[model samples]
Target: MFCNQCEQTAKGIGCEKVGVCGKNEGVASLQDLLTHALQGLAIVAVAARKVGIVDPAVDHFTAEATFACLTNVDFDPARFETWIRKTVELRDSLRARAEGAGATISNDTPALSYRPAADLAGLEAQGVALNFIPSLDENEDLRSLKQITLYGLRGLAAYTDHAAILGQESDEVYAFLQQALADLTRNDLGLDELVALVLKCGEVNLKAMELLDAGNTGTYGHPVPTPVPLGHKAGKAILVSGHDLRDLQLLLEQTKDKGIFVYTHGEMLPCHAYPELKKHPHFYGHYGTAWQNQQKEFAEFPGAILFTTNCIQKPRESYQDNVFTTGLVGWPGLTHIGEDKDFTPVIERALALPGFPNDEDKGEVLTGFARNTVLGVADKVIEGVKSGAIKHFFLVGGCDGAKPGRNYYTEFVEQVPQDCIVLTLACGKFRFFDKKLGDIGGIPRLLDVGQCNDAYSAIQIAVALAGAFDCGVNDLPLSLILSWYEQKAVIILLTLLHLGIKDIRLGPTLPAFITPNVLNVLVDNFAIKPISATPQEDLQAILA
Candidate 1:
């Protein structure tokens, strides 16, 4: 199995045997097969759409299928097998309809004609040949650019899927996703065409994120400044992780009077800020820190656990039986909730377990400082800047990983001066989120901007600050120190690049797919820089 689609890829090259994230060879190969199958579906979807035949089901399925293949998202080969067959069936259905309308799809394309392996062995054989590294385009630059585009689409699918489930759908986003996927197989495309597609992916992913933000804020009112308890509450408690607000809401609704307490974990920590969701008394407290620490965190948690999306680690035996997965997330033996959204299985396990025997009150941290919350106080922020009270603004946010170097973020945040405000989003904030970074006057030094998708909120805040100051964003005292763990981070980075954001610091390690030439292109064009070895050095460099 050859895979290196994440920041934690083995030695920053490729995971040739077992995935560093604990994905076995079988699971890795199946993910590759699933990725290949989605490419096929995209070819069919793009062709059919041209003849005025747009299947929202096909578009939805394509987005969801691609999402299922994201890093650390789905690891069940059995699930991949089922999804692979479904993809082929969807592609064929679309192809036949298009053919009836005289839009001929040739069987000559290998991607469209792929048959699912009858069993796991056959799946491996099919996938072994479909490894992504081989350059179909002789030009190395074009090939690297193609891969970068595909990675962004994978991220786009994740956001699109979330928005879709919440009853928010964008045909334009879906169309661009399909077309982008199909471009991977197009050998006729030139370098300029591929680069444009990558940027367009950024443009559309921004739209997809906007749709999700709207769906989230519209369904559950815009997040307000609310203090979330970091302590564990007494009673039967369940920890809901990942970034799905809809799942958390449904679980909270069902568990409402059942005496079950639902605590947010990882990316779900920000859910506490929503007025509609937080109104529930049982929706209490946040458990654990970021996604990378889940192995230890999930085990220590007394109650059941529910994963609503990506960044799921292989469950430890101690807590394996107590864990459940829903949405696009999956693991081998975990209980999975379907579209019915009935979490009775998860609820039953929570009740049957021995929850926190004694209340452990750790402390509290304030979140939900989303765009609306920040923009409402734009005048104050503008004043803080003008008066020289808030010296600098650091956006230290993204997904966290298990590597030891991840300590850089914690140490870096530890070193940030008290006068500087820190804006954070996603799970990366877990590094120093609990630390009491004192406020400058009434404004808290550390600001939580909802989930990773809420990077949209962070961007809005930055743009708003620049607008109020009557200067470009770069002219403002702002710096972005981002850490990426999965595909969603990839698209977010691309979106920043597309917007011409410069001099951002990205670490724990760069993507392996980015060859030296590609890295040079980024450095030359975007002025992107890697984090220094010492947090002190990196922090000093950023503030300098």
Candidate 2:
């Protein structure tokens, strides 16, 4: 099996033998089979839509299935088998409906008529024989463009699924996703067309993110400036990680007055800023850093750990039994919380664990500087800019990985001039989140703008700032220094490109799938730059 859909792909190339994310050959092949099955389902779904027969279940299933294939999400081979079978079943059902509606369903497209093997082993064998990655395209540039679109769709599906969970749905986003998947079956498309499709994925992702932003803020209330403790209170505890706010909300409800203090971990760190979530008396402080450090950090946590979405690493024996997965996240042996969202087992385990021995005051960091909070002080920011007190704005954030060279972000933040305000989001901020950058006037210099789920919030802040200054977004005194590790970051970059944002710096290494030709196209068109040899260098270049 060969896979290079993430930044940390083995040796910065395709992972041929095993995944860098700990997905063994079996799990990798199963994920490949699952993706192949979804492409078939998507072909049928797209055909059905043409005949004006669209199934909401089919649309939602397509998103969930696609998202499950994303890196670090689901590592359970059994789960992939179930989803692969379900995809074929859904494809058959949708095809019948489309045929009944007088749609000309053709078997010429193999994906439409593709059949899965009966068992997991057979499915894996079929997947290996079918070989998804190497068969993408012969043209290096076109393949790179298609990989961008494919990964972007995976990220968009995740955001789409999260929004749909909160009762937010958009037909346009679903239509685009299925259509893009269907388009992957075509070999006639050229580089320009594939590039167009890749950018369109970004455009659609922006819409998906908007839907998610509405869902999150609408359900949890727009985040306010709230201080989240880095320390812990002595008690029974459950650390919630990943990016699902609703799961955390439900767990908080289930454990209310049960003596379990729910601590936020990883991307869940920003949940403390949401009024609906934070109002829970038992909802407590944050624990640990980013996803890559989870194996060590989680093992040390004294109570049960719950992963609400993705970013789950292979659990070690030390904390394996103590970890539970909900939503689409999966690992072989760990208990999974189903759609019922009961979280009863998690509570029981938390109650059983040692939890914190005593109160620890590790101080705190400020969060909730989302679009609403930041834009609410637009006048002050505008004034700061005019008065030259805030000389520049650096948006240094993205996914954090275990790879070397990530310390660039830490040093980058440290070297940011005193007069500049640093706006950050996602797990990457863990590098220097606790730094005392102080503030320009009353505004904090280092602003935590929620998780990667809050990319829309950061985008909105930039757009709002641009509007306030009567200039284009790129014309504003801002720079995007991003680090990408997964498909979500891929889609975010595509979104930035879609918005015509230029001169962005991306690093920790460019994607392995992006050929030099495609890289040149990006550099020529968007002026995209790889992060310089040093943060100091990039900072000088940006501030120059």
Candidate 3:
């Protein structure tokens, strides 16, 4: 039951006895088995492709299965057991179809199938099956390289699953995951092949990101600059967390006019900027800072907290009864909202609670109005630049984690030059939310672009700025100093690479899965570097 695929792995290493995320040994082992089975499915899909029989269902199942194994995604061993059985059934069905059609499949890999060992004595009996273990390459470097690619795909699958729930599907991304997963299972492949697949994972993940961006913006309208309230109003309220905008939208709709105020939590904080979502008068401001503060933040709150996706920690008994989970996020004893997307139970609980004595509105928290909204004020922004008011643009954003080294983001934002504008997104901005970074001319110094998915907005703004200056994106005065905590970051990094953007700095710690060979490829190709020294020094290097 050793798992360390996330930032909050127990004790900064693998979670051995029990997952800090509340996943038990059985659930962890099942997730491992599920991952192994998905890889097996990928093997079959890839082989079938060689024979010109590419089943889209096989590709999608692989994506969903891989996504389910992501950190904090599936904690219910019972649910995953069903998924495993279903996957095996799918694999067998696919094989039967191919054989019935008389298609000559060259690769004869066994279908996705596994049985628990006969002896269920202790921890070792429940440990992940050997087949599920990532192949241990003869070369230590290659093993690391395979891990990086595999983990990166796991992250990509998570994002893709979110998009799928919103009715956004990309065949190309699914196909790429199948191809990449199959490639990881191949120990015969050399460093060059694995490296190419690593970069390709990045490329396809970029497309996946674009699809999600479109899904969000197209459905909700472009996010505009809007200030969210920080104070919780009296009465019943619901705190919606995680990164799924669609879930947030549904909750907002169901709770509207019901006297239950909806507030954005964690990554959902950015949803307030969307015109369609913001129009809801009852949509309150953000609740707390980041995911890590949830245990304290959720304590004794007057309402239920609904988790739409990842980054949920095991709840304390005090608030455990009030927490509701929807979509793929699951945990024992938590109320789960099913596929219907109905959130009535959460709304009901919020109403049942004795809310604040009055409508206690928190003060204004600035957000919304990202690139498109900002671009709407493009004339003003361009004028400010021409007037020498807005000097430099600092893109400071990425995931937030429990690691102490994450304090770098706080220090980095605090140290930004007064005249420079700080653009942020995702949970990483929580580090400096209290800072009075001050605005350049009229704009605020800390401008939140949106969620991590809104990295697209950051990219759009950079490209537009490059176009305005008649230069390449890399030549613009903007600098990307990012903090990554998960796979979504991996996809965003790939997008940056796909655009040929260089000199990007990442931190707080480098992924343990990346082998030296793979790291060398990224260094040589993109000049990506780890965050070191003080932010001042890093800023100097980027400016230089």
Candidate 4:
């Protein structure tokens, strides 16, 4: 297995045996095979589109299958086998229709005619033999760019799936996904073409995120400023983690009067600010920090846990029985809730367990400063900036990881000037999320802008602020200090680049997949920089 698509790739190169995320060689190879199959499906799907044969099911499956390959989303090799078979099934179906319509299908690559092995063991062997990552391109530089596009699409697929779940769908987004996947299977594309496709991945991801923002806010209502308890309520409880709101809502409804108090965990923390969700009296406060800390945190929680999306750790035996997974998230033995959205198993498990024995007030933290809430107070923010009370804005947020350098975000947020406003999103905010940064002219100095899934909210906030100041987003006295762990962050960075945003500082370590030549292109065109030796050093340069 050769996997290097994440921030913490083993030894900062590639995970050649077991993945640092606990993905075994079998699962890693299966994921690669699934991705390879998707490329074949994409090639056929793109041809089908030429013949006006677009199937929504094919489009949705393409997104879900690609998303399933994302880091930490699914660890069960069985699930990968299922996805691989389904991808081939869809590809064959599309190929038949397209050929019937006189559209020629490409069989130039083995993926075009590939078939999965009859069993999991055989399939794993097939995947290892056909592994495409190392052999993608003879040119290391072009291979690096392909890696970027591939991972960016993984992130894009995730967002697209999230939006589709909430009844937001776009053909354009689906079309781009197919075309990009097909383009990836080509060998003639040069560096510039690949770079443009990478940027386009970012641009389409913005649309996906916007659709998700609409689905979330339209369904749950715009998040309002709400203070959520870090404390636990004494009773039966179910902790929901990951980034799916619909899963949380379904669980909340099923456990409504059943004495199970639902608590948000990880990225689900922002769900508490949504009006429809917050109205549940049994819905309790947040528990734990980011996804990286789940092993320690989930072990201590007394009740059942439901993981709605990604950010899953290999479950330790102690609490493995207490955990359940739903949607596209999968673990080998965890009870998976199906499309029916039923929470009976989770509810029964919560009932069987002893929840928090006593109430503990760990104080509270404020959230719900998404675009709507922030823009609602646009006048106040504008006035504060004009009066120099809010001298600058620092957007210091992205995916957080367990690496040593992550302390940079916490320390960086600490060093942010008192007069400046700090807007953060995703799990990275956990570093200084609970810090009391006070307020400037009635505006909270530290604003929690929802989850990484709510990145559209953050982008909208920046755009609105830019409009208010009559400047481009890059000119709005804002410095983006972002830390990425997985594919979602990759696509979000691409979106920022797509907008021609410049001078951004990214770190904890740049992606292992980014070749120096490609990094130079980013640096020359966008002035992108690695995080400084110290947050203080970066701060001095930015404030200069």
Higher-ranked by TM-score: 1 or 2: 2
Clashing pairs in 4: none
Cα lDDT, all candidates: 0.87, 0.91, 0.77, 0.92
Model 1 whole-model lDDT (C-alpha atoms): 0.87
Q: Candidate 3 — which residues are off by over 4 angstroms?
A: 8-13, 20-22, 49-57, 106-127, 131-136, 379-387
Residue-by-residue lDDT tens digits, candidate 4, 371-490: 989999999989988988988989989999987889989999999889899999999999999999999888999999999977788888889989887899988888899999999999
Using lDDT as the yardstick, the better of models 1 and 2 is 2
Q: List candidate 1 stretches off by more than 4 Å.
A: 135-138
lDDT of 3 by residue, 486-510 (tens): 7677767876886888988888877
Among residues 3 or more apart in sequence or in different chains, the pairs in candidate 1 whose N, CA or C atoms overlap within 3 Å are: none
lDDT of 4 at 108: 93
RMSD of 2: 0.8
Residue-level lDDT for 448 in candidate 1 = 94
What would you estimate as the lDDT of candidate 4?
A: 0.92
Candidate 3 TM-score over all chains jointly: 0.92
